[model samples]
Target: MEELICMDRSQRLFEDSRKVLVGGVNSPVRAMKPYPFFVERAEGCRLYDADGRSYIDYCLGYGPLILGHANPAVVDAVAAQLEKGTLYGAPTELEIDFARKIAKHVPSAEMVRFVNTGTEATMGAIRLARGVTGKNRFVKFEGAFHGAHDYVLVKAGSGATTQGVPNSAGIPADTTKNTILAPFNDEEAIERIVEEEDDLACIILEPIIGNIGCVMPKPGYLRFLRKITKEHEVLLIFDEVITGFRLGLGGAQGYYGVKPDITTLGKILGGGLPIGCIASTRDVMEHMAPVGEVYQAGTFNGNPLSMTAGLAAIGELERPGVYEALEKTGGYMRKGLRDISEDLGIDTRVYGVASMYQMYFTGEEVTDYQSALRADKELFLRYQQELLKKGVFLPPSQYECNFISTAHREEDIERTLVEMESALRTVL
Candidate 1:
């Protein structure tokens, strides 16, 4: 049987979930149109949904599950940690070890402070920048989402940043008063902003710009930002939440060979658990409390459960050929997609670095948010829904990037292409 009534079963669950949940989900991204599937379990590259439908999972928990879902190493590590404890509401050796691992792997992470999510990491970075520089204003790119926090929300990247504007509803107008927005990949705009707004404490950006559909900086753009920020005495922060440990060992900073004054990390660091970190030189980091006067703390800041998972995840990622394999797979898939799109006579542009990618439904290149926005939203939606129907799950919205994991094989990529060809045929 083809699971003919499976959608009906899924509809009932979503309808029931709505009564108790906001927008029927915890996060807005989870609320895809026609209802998102409630997955029962996941292993390797596949997810088993509540209705017993097996799907090829390209979402990969939005870029964290690089080792893939329920890998034995990750599960064993978590299981072992369970014997010790969960949340101590205090510090542990695991946190220190994990921090050390991050410092060793990530080139710019000299000193790190942990938080629960990428949102907190970027939010704290902004606050700390203001505290250190004694300035109120900041600058962010048009489509680089740092998090849901009010200060960096404007011209927000990803979900909020994708549709347009800063905050959806919860933020006050005064929150974004000091936050200035500029077009990504435009060196002149940033140069002008620093010249005009002398009070800018920091300039933060995603080196690879994953949220705005996996766009990359134009040639020398990242280096230009670094040079401009240094000349202005403004701190440069790389919001590598999605890029950290995914693109390469040291992240986009390492991959692009451009170093920023500060870097925020999440996603891969936690191994699919909740964790984020902001790091910089010791002098700037000393400004935080216990070292200097800037105050920041968390009750569950370095939970052992997440720390153990993180430690294990980072260790496993260190294995030789891990990233190389991911890149190879990513390259294979990208080529397959490009070939298919070309065959279908669909105008498309695929942009990326390493395992992260986005397919823009336009012939034009996407060097920044403005160019990324030129992609076809209607076609993207139709394609996404069609792919889902064909048992392959891409990011629900066109704004998010498609992530590849080490678990994905050549067969998986070919299978995805097969499904993509079918979907393209329908959509075109």
Candidate 2:
């Protein structure tokens, strides 16, 4: 395995890096079996490794690069803003602009506060919910990731779920004891839990789950959730870090036509920069700091670089027909992959909504994490290696979603399909 030419350099890097970095990678999922390939550069939909091998990148930084790498607009915006300044503890107009832009694009958004990561956004939202409702307990779904925070880390101890005990060693049991867990698509579990736990302050979910592969809420599941949360005096929060601009200008809420009381956005919000935000109605948002009690602050909360990149990225996403193009591209990819698997007699199921899709290497419906776990991991591993060999790069983790950027054209799409056919043949 180490002798493989295409992956040898990556394997070497992992070995060298392990002495200094945990698992030889900054992030766990990036620690693939053959070691993660160290990217030298990326352009459009392609990534070039240190070994000088180019591959069509499907990981897209785990669903953030909806516009692809170094998009001229986003890059130029970040670069230009850097000349002005990097960070200032003081607030800037760019902050207001970005917030206004986000609120304008997302209907459910009336007021917004910026943070540095998705974890922070969710953390802030949870506190705000507790502050606003005067309740402590909350409801979270199984296998839905809300960043590496403590409270939302229940049943989610998947990627960073240290020991698969909901909360890691550092987090006391009391933190998650109130954090009730329910399976995705099981509204009954949620309703029953809400009925039992009258103190439940909020209910948060990914809407279209991406942590454990892309799983859409079944039928009126979201509507039912919204109803339950509202009826129970609980705030419904949508963790849209992945779904944000990737689904549409309004994210999953707009895509599904259901509104959550609060939405935490990350990934695409700052183009490729690290940023996250929590947006809610005026009444709900006012509960933070100056206006109320709950406090959330960051020195780089609205750094100029991220603000500019976000402005450009959101502008592009808000462009008319942008989502339509995404729908077409995502649909094409889903069909192409399904056809390839069927031709190779490989069992597979594609689940997701809008531009997001998940491919499970089993001929069964994957509605939740339990069902997704039934997939053929060995086949997925072989598929990953085969695709990499064919100059295509996908997220190594079977539990993550690979994205399709607008930069992908018919030609790029066709090449991916060709590689898929060849890779499927090799794996099967």
Candidate 3:
């Protein structure tokens, strides 16, 4: 067995935190077994914990730090914005600049409305869809997490799945009754739902299901959705919070060559800051606010800091070879992990695309949430802990996808593979 890394300071902090914080962490997924390590600071692709232990971070702040932590461009932009002011509750030129950039890159973003988080972005998108179509029902795939909103919590992935509560207790039955759940990669299920439910407002989904350990869409699946949703007179909304800039500047919509009626972007769009946006065609977006009756507003929406950071972060992404480099590294990592599992004769399924990946302990392919649920969660957690001992930090959940950043160099990837192999050996 590998010797556990010392986390005495972090252990003490967790004890103190538990008295005041829920589950000793703000987010449920941060609740790692044997207590989570409290990060003191992060730079590039590494996290320095309270115990002074450094780890190569694949969590990447849950998919926001694509350019990596404490990026100079983002830091400088935010710093400059701080000198000017923080929040104005009023419009700024920076917001316009950021929105313009989003429209330039994202295929579906001709107009935009900024919000505070991915949750807010999705909530607004769903509401807008309902208002536009004057319909009550919407379709979401099983184990696909849009956010922690009441409407989409029925079969959520991420922390909800990790905590063994896909359906939370507080939500009323009426809220979820209208939410129809379908299995991913299944066209027949969607066809039935569309035919049966006459008042369907929209079909919202993550193009690549990142919440359920990065499941890719089957061939023609996205195109199938675009066609069917159009035929049914239902709007198509793409929740690209994780995949927005992570896949490429165009996000999953561009990568798959299928555009949606509405797109929700967060995470990387904020550049490690709090930001989310619901974007669509000018005609659709005009339906929001003073322009139209679908009301959505926030004090922090289009706040200067997030706008500045987003602009700067995206500007960096606009540089040549960024996506190519990320693709190459991602491919390398996936191949290496698959090879290690094969070499060890371990029963595992490696899944990923671009800079996202995960290894399910089950031998079968993970094409949907049901298959993903069959993977040995306890075994995956054991492997995660083992990797932590070797200075590698994953998200600490089998259901959450691991990420790679531009800050991750060749040496980082090589060392991670070595550690991963050792961790797999120790656990399996």
- Among these predictions, the greatest TM-score belongs to 3
Global local distance difference test of model 1: 0.86
Lowest summed-lDDT stretch of 10 residues in model 2? 157-166
**260-363 per-residue lDDT for model 2 (tens digits):** 99999999998899999999999999999888899988888888888888899887887788889989998998988888777777778987656677788887
Clashing pairs in 1: 145-157, 156-161
- The better candidate by TM-score, 1 or 2, is 1
Arrange candidates, best lDDT first.
Answer: 3, 1, 2
**Candidate-wise lDDT, in order:** 0.86, 0.84, 0.94
Among all windows of 10 consecutive residues in model 1, the one with the lowest summed lDDT is: 1-10
Error of 3 at 154 (Å): 0.7
Q: Report the lDDT tens digits of candidate 3 across residue range 1-428.
A: 13224538788788889999998999998999899998999999999998789999999999999999999999998999899999997889998998899999999999999999999999999999998999999999999999999999988999999999999999999878989999999999999999999999999999999998989999999999999999999999999999999889999999999999999999999999999999999889988988999999998989999999999999999999999999999999999999998999989988888899988999888999999999999999999999999999999898999999999999999999999999988887
C-alpha lDDT of candidate 3 relative to the true structure: 0.94
Q: Flag the better candidate by lDDT, 2 or 3.
A: 3
Q: List per-candidate RMSD values in Å.
A: 2.2, 2.3, 2.5
Once fitted onto the true fold, the runs of candidate 1 whose alpha carbons sit more than 4 angstroms away are: 1-7, 161-166
